[model samples]
Target chain A: MTFNRRNFLGVAIAGTAALSAPRVLGQAKPHVVIVGGGAGGATAARYIAKDSDGAIDVTLIEPTRKYYTCFFSNLYIGGFRDFASIGHTYGGLASDYGVNVVHDWVIGVDRDAMTVTTAAGHSFGYDRLIVAPGIDFVEGSVPGWSTAAQNKMPHSWKAGSQTQLLKAQIEAMPEGGTYCMVAPPNPFRCPPGPYERVSMVAHVLKASNPTAKILIVDPKEKFSKQALFEEGWNKHYAGMIERVGPDFGGANVSVNPDAMEVDIDGTVEKVDVCNVIPAQKAGHIAHAMGLTNDSGFCPIDPATMQSQVDENIHVLGDATIAGDMPKSGFSANSQAKVAAMAVRGALTDSRVFPAKYSNTCWSLIDTEDGIKVGASYQATDEKIAKVDGFISQTGEDAALRKATFEESLGWYAGITADMFG
Target chain B: MRERVFFALALALGGAGEGAADGHAEAIGDAERGAEIWVYCSGCHQIGPDAEIGIGPPLTGIFGRRAASVEGFPYSKSMSRMGSDGLTWTLTTLDAYIENPLVLVSGTRMSFEGLEDPTERADLLAFLREYSDKPSNIPEAAPTARPDYPKLSEETLALVGDEAYGEYLSSECTTCHQRDGSDQGIPSITLWPEKDFVVAMHAYKQKLRPHPVMQMMASRLSDEEIAALAAYFGSLSN
Candidate 1:
């Protein structure tokens, strides 16, 4: 047979017809319903739809039309990134990848029925369900502080307007005033996040109020990349930041939002600004679906990210007790790819690859002073465990730090594109 | 007659012989496989039209070209000196260099540990060849002088795999590999080919691979243990 342009065009037209035959025949395609269109859900929805070549129906349920990444919201607070840079829409997921992006809250899940009922009264049936609800703050973790008092003492952990509110509060602080941060207990989203936030807060305060003192009340003695953060705090914002550990009345803390007073073991301290990052658990939907354990996070099979509670459902990102992996956006995005692959294989009988995962958390300290901690991970029978890891050493030269910071900017762009598209 | 003429031209161009070319024709180290291997190189190097300089120079038209020739790219002193000393990229040279960059030029700034698997290197070379100006002239065969890996026998496959045992052994593997299938700078190892898994572990164990941590980890595993891991990871659906 002679292969000419006419012949190729004929074959191409025939191929297009063959590809569209299923839809033309009105055959129902397998549906993948993803809840919580954050890094995990959005990525899974995109990958499944893109890779399946329209054979799988993908639906993404997110309450918000636009997503504000908690990853670099601290940069927004520190004035490194604008609020617009952190915000992303699902238009690309909808238009580019053919995902049915539904802007509605997932109210409940019927696992036996393999369906999800949204707050808008829409029900989505799925061959596979991915839950990536991210995190929700534990109510009243700090005494006299709740969601109602968030306006007074902005948690600002979830990004969005609260981040803007906190930024405004920090910028409005009086000269030589105090900015107190009540850090959360262990196993929270972004382990180094609170520290990076403190660094960003200091970065902002140093330029505006050089005499402004920042205080940290922490429950844990050591945090992620403690030495690096402490060194940065001392080097860049020395005499401006004070961290109070449990030994020094860091723990045993309570707050009064009405009076704007923080009591550290009955020691009342009135501050100009209070950034309370309350203790957190998996988002409410996880609890409602009975996916979480006593630790308030979902347990999963490391090999496939299938929930230990139910094999039909998978959990990703900050919501899962992810072995050695931290609850960061990077971790969540990584898990989403694996989950997507597994879901595709389960639904479409595609080739499945072994699960390999990696995550790196970059923290910016002042301008061009960036540090990172990262590791590669593989799935063992027990859990996702860390392999080797690396962190930027203290006292590194400015040039190297600048390069590291630049690398992080590239990563932010790359990861955001990976998630949204 | 066409195959004979192609082989004759390939031989005249100092490419691979018929035996090696025929092996590649069977798809052992085809361009498609090479593209998969190229993901490792993509971190530093780029190829194809419109490829720009990254951490490493763009590798478009690299075949038979002088090393460090791309303008505006900052080459290490050693690389510049090597280029001046008559270093040129060819299938053979690339095969050697990619296997161990430091060995080829001791002070070169390219920090890639190098492709330890000869098949993977051949695959990458095949992919890179396509981006060159004279792709047809480039070799399509695996290099003659290459490291030999221990073959996994049918007996080994039948005897070694115990999913439970493999899972028990994989705790160390998961340390660096996120079970959630995320790729940081590190590549994910989920659902890897069982044969590829065994070969790679054996390479690391025998000190043929360059990563210090992998070498240490591989050194501790026995053949059965490695096979068991291969089985466990191969069974994954992610």
Candidate 2:
């Protein structure tokens, strides 16, 4: 079938009834209901259905028809990839994999009843459940800034419209204007994501508004790939990007989105554009499901990605407190596969391999300049521990960096196929 | 534990004859363990047919082949010179080279810190021997390859696949692959642009991709069935 955005949306809308009708009749097949069809949920849904060969019924509950990946959304902001390329739909998941793709918000999950209640007033029973709702920002973490002021100070962290808004704001910055960013606290989605955003914002500002200054008010003393990002910023966008860490009052920051002003410690500075990424927790659904612990993220068995709270329910993606692995799209995708394998083993009695996970997060510092950090992981009794790892050393040659960048493109292609297909 | 003790006995027996005789028997490694060790090599090098040139050269048929001998691969000057100096990749040479490539030939470009464990090196050698097309003489104690998937023959390629029939078989595939030839994580199999669809399918069938579900699915299909699916998907254009 020819799949495009319009036709896909049409199919999703048309097929919703047919998809849900069968399950409501109480089919004998073991049903796997997945929430939030992003990296983790989509992958788990596809894998379970595809591997089971129609033996298991799979239903993916995602509110949005089109998912904009947070992985390369930074590149979209940097003008490397267009906005459309990052957006994906559930057409393939429904049509190709025999998955029931329901476009609805899951309001509640009753673990005891083994049912998920959607906002559309429908309840779907599942033998197994996967919750991969990604992340939700902590309200009031950035004083005076809330979801209402998102337009004035966008946090393109979730992708979609916010990403577009942030891109436009960067492009619309006045010459020599300051673009201040309030970086999130620790244990946020994509440790290097905020820094990568800074690089992307700098890339746009450098080309369009050369004199524009980019200031990052970061809560942490150091971040993922700190040295590499710093080196890139110094070499490429010299004097344009400046990062203030906690020791320098970066932690004591408040943004008045209404006034377009930022207060760092006691000093107040008015900015042209404010990108505030507040502290984050597991997507609200996990909390609602009572899956989250004190850390505000769900804990899972490293071997299976099954929630500690509920063995029948597996939690994946940025929502899970995966040890040693950073909260990145690559990590989520890797975790999903492990969970899928475990699910398949439990349901279909398939041969289960030892849980081996790997992730490589590639960041484009500038055009053709890419850096990466990756490690192979093995699940022990306690957590997923890193085996051996590699990182792009500072002062890598342009050719190698370009090759690394190109490698990331292949990964993006490969991983997306792995998830969506 | 039994295997380790046997390995230790083999090493003890060979200690006196180390320099006088070829240590092929001493280096007889367990191919099963080698498969595990090969995971480290997989990050850069690939083995088996249809394996593309990646960060490192494909290691298929590497046994007995000269160092830096693979056509189209750009070997470092040091490696090329070593090959030119008649450095063949026999079990002994392979063992030494894999243990310490830089030490074996100074200035070689292979950046892996050498496999320090002797048993691991031996096992990797045993695994490589099983895959090499024109394998060198195997030692008596060398382990055999895992009997998972059969190697493809010329007849398998000659078998014609019905594209129309393949279209019926492709619903499972198109779920992840975009009609426009875009890819997500599964890779764009449309147009057969990257590789021969049959060869790629065979790779999955042989569990070369190491994805268990893909292996299981591929294992269930006949050669003709795979060909038909490949024919349909391969005929697609971007």
Candidate 3:
């Protein structure tokens, strides 16, 4: 317990390390640059800024000023929510949390120099970087469909105007017109999204055009919450929606956007409206930064969300191949906090706590009918391992289902508040 | 009779008259209004004729009953300690618990967020009273609820939470319960009395709370972790 000669030598070496820290040297506070100011990046920025209390410089760079969440965009199509309700801004992060909100696209990153270059030509030097650029469609993943043809057959997978366009097309269809969807393959954002979208589309048509039909062409053999979705479909929209799985050649499909037609395997069918959600990859910025792998998703250390490729860089949200956690806003928001805590502890000597992650996905089938699946996870040596979970059961009483639906609304408010503020 | 003595004691401590038993439970609050608020309690407490121990000890006879007296109910260790110390429930005690549960028994596992509004607490208590043995000679309503053994065991409540650690642990909770105390469909958990917060969370951790999401979130928290979260969130203002 005494500070003897050996302890004195150890103290001298530790003192050198402490002096090198920017906070100790009275230099500019350690700067943290975050990209893709959506759920992950925004929450990371907010946490770091709020926790550090001016001890760290947090700069959040994103191209969009108004971020629209993809999680609830389907509810908008079904008319359960207004378009404006899903959109959030970074003003809160700037004013309340003291984050530097830069509304510009990132052009490049010089990792060795620890600097980020944006299209505006501004350069930001950082002690730590967090990338959470979400997802981008794989070019030509669906034959005859690309961003060029997006105006004709909208993807609506990324939300924003594409979602509005898809909803408009579905509404404008003739009385007996067909609405077709080419769903994405395995490991897409929002696992229950495509089926839920179909449910919402059918909900609108059941009121406006009862004779209208909805068709789904999914490449996956099965999906998250398949039984629940199927039960709800039969109970609410029976005879109105149809799905063709990989067994039925759903994977072997293409579309002609101009002609408004879908080619399922060898059969060509005419449809009034088509929505093609293509194969996905980590957002382009992740690729540009050389962080993603052949899996088309960046791999990260499950414990800290640190990039496997770059020690100084951390990746979050849908862009990262988070083991066991699905690509959802809740997952992104959860990952961001761990990254922020690690970042703060690294730069500011803040207390580093054990990493915990959890996710819950809620989907609405029809009026007053909602379902959810959730799990709590702990970081194991291999991955973010699931510890416990629960899902809404089939044939649950109407009141319970209604409560779950209302809970989703509260979660929306809660998560967005967690993100934006 | 033991029952007679406790009832008279309850009336004396509560400071109300027997006129409350005829559904005019004004000593606590309107029993009628409490029925509407019963939706909040029914998930755990299942009172009235079919009362049964579920997530919590049934409130079948919560009023004037000793703490944790329901046999076969899985009471928390600390709650069992309080019950063993001769802590009995009266209208005043029920009001204090419903208003802020852990104030009287810090480690007890009744997970309900204490009803903040006094009238609401009174109504909820009156609703709970409907199942208890009828009032005797006087209305049992005044603010005299006191635990026979008031102080918590030093060993059980000794862990002083690290605020920084609590801040990090609270990230999981903030996903569904807002930090700013905004209650949409989920109740706001911010700015609770630290002891009350610990009890509410332990309720979930012990599988006494009903919501799946909250139960899952709470199940994995160690005791110190829950204490830390309680400390940090407790420091916030509503």
Candidate 4:
């Protein structure tokens, strides 16, 4: 039978009554359908399933069975970790946490009927839905660069093949060649990502191709950890890296992956490799569901991570306009906990706690040298406001830097375990 | 005990000092909420003017007291040792010990599992502060001087890790320090009492030990998270 509105309302009403009744054997459990099993969705699915202990059914839909986290993909390029180490399978979430892991791309969301349609012709009904489809690049944000040209000028922003391809291209660059990066504008995932990638590439080239030059054509006037990155570049890779900010016409940039040329305003320069990170918007599913606003991202209630557009729908991670929080995996994981608690409280008679968020982004500049920026946040009426923060200083001792790097490794292990289990 | 309580209230002298002006004097906690939480402690101890010790010593004024300062009290040997070792109860020490008594003093006989909720701890401390030595006339005086605790740990937040025991083990030194060791300078303290070791860790966790690495390692640990580490290392010699 078709999952039309009339049929949905009938089942939804019955499901609502079932939720209020004492849960026992043979009772219909409230189902929570989640789209995009990245940091946010996977963590939420795990939390709800594990915490509820079978009171709520969790279905996580994604296109990939082996999820590659974007957070540590840059480190994979830097050779700090193997590609497989960053790629995690949903076996644990499935076997251990009892999450129904569905490997399918979500095609559409019937908001009126409260159902999600998948590309495989399956429809999932939900008592609540969490949309955590990370981000999608705007069609024409970067002139002369598109997903079709992605192979030639790999935008390894998303992990997996693109990441491997970008790493390979950087390694294969001719000795003394140039590596050019067109950084994205504000409100992008992982604010320090592009710079960290540049560092990783330079770390590779500095060893293999010593005289290779790295150029950053950044649209923003300043970037995250600008001071720390600059100091590290000057000290470690002196005269090896150059960045052109908006003042130097960095904003007006175009790339030709075929010709291997980058035009900055009017001047054109031939480069060996170009990594184009274009402006991004909420995933197509969010837009398709009419959840995103004019900013191309979904605005959420700071207290619950619930989409302001729809009460039954929640948004997480890079797709959200999280106030005062950078779009990082840590942020997404933090937001996921809040959304999970809210979802459980609404569906079941669970205890609802006040919302708290915290995030830390660790960027490695060179071997054994890592810098971190982090802040703890509290949900206020306006938004998630920053309470306290700490950043690694420019002149930190070598021992401290090594310790910070070690701490980051611990965090990666902790978060992935938190997500998958 | 009176000295420590007075010291915390000392910061409140001059009624509204520069500390309060600069917003350093935030409320210690809500005593009303704290009173509700005191039920967990009331089984072993008592507070207020007519209070008396039951299973544990009377905690009428515990803040400034040494580990085993109460007169005629048959405190645990470890706590008595800690008292002699100069383990005074300031606000920081009180907060840490109340969060997890076993973590602060491994041999303490107080069988109450700690208050893991930091807000509840703060509120309980607020209620206990009522029974602490305070001048009732100074209405706006700082309740109890909490020397700059991290706001995140208090703002009704919690991070629940599954391998809490494993993470607790990470903060402990026995993973590196040996059951048998006395190399050049490292002593063969495998025979050392668990109470001494727990007291040393309390110093490190409280930033009293003042080493960078140890502080970082201990700061993130929750109450029950460290129980396994203490149980494993505390009895190593046995």
| CAPRI verdict (incorrect, acceptable, medium, high) for model 3 | acceptable
What residue runs in model 3 are displaced by over 4 Å at the alpha carbon?
A: A1-27, B1-154
Model 1: per-residue Cα lDDT over A1-421, one tens digit each: 1114344334334443444222222235667789998878887887788778898889899999889999899999999999999999999988988999999998987776567888888876665789999999899788889999999999998989999999999999988999999999999999999999999999988899999999999999899999999999889999988989999888799999989999998899999899999999999999999999999999998988999998778999999999999998888888887887777677665656677677778899889898888877889989999876667788876755775686577567667777776
Can you rank all candidates by lDDT, best first? 3, 1, 2, 4
Which 10 consecutive residues of model 2 chain B have the lowest summed lDDT?
B141-150
Using lDDT as the yardstick, the better of models 1 and 2 is: 1
Candidate No. with top lDDT: 3
lDDT at A33, model 2 = 92
lDDT of each: 0.77, 0.76, 0.81, 0.74
**Candidate 4 residue lDDT tens string, A233-352:** 887899899999999999999988899989999899999989999999998889989999999999999989999998878999999999999999888888888888888878776766
- In angstroms, give how far residue B34 of model 1 lies from its true place: 36
- Which of 3 and 4 is the better model by TM-score? 3
lDDT of 2 by residue, A1-421 (tens): 0114344334333433345432444344667899999888988888788878898889999999899999899999999999999999989989999999999999987665577889999888776789999999999899989999999999988999999999998888888999999999989998889888899988998888999999999989889998999999999999998888999999999988778999999899999999999999999999999999999999999999999998878999899989888888877877887788777777665656567666678899999898888766778878888875667789876755775686578677766777887
Q: What is model 4's native contact fraction?
A: 0.00
Where does model 4 exceed 4 Å of error?
Answer: A1-11, A14-27, B1-238
Q: For each candidate, what's the DockQ?
A: 0.03, 0.04, 0.33, 0.03
The A-chain TM-scores of all the candidates are 0.93, 0.94, 0.94, 0.94
10 residues in a row with least lDDT, candidate 3 chain A: A1-10
Clashing pairs in 2: A414-B185, A415-B185, A416-B184, A416-B185, A417-B184, A417-B185, A417-B186, A418-B185, A418-B186, A421-B176
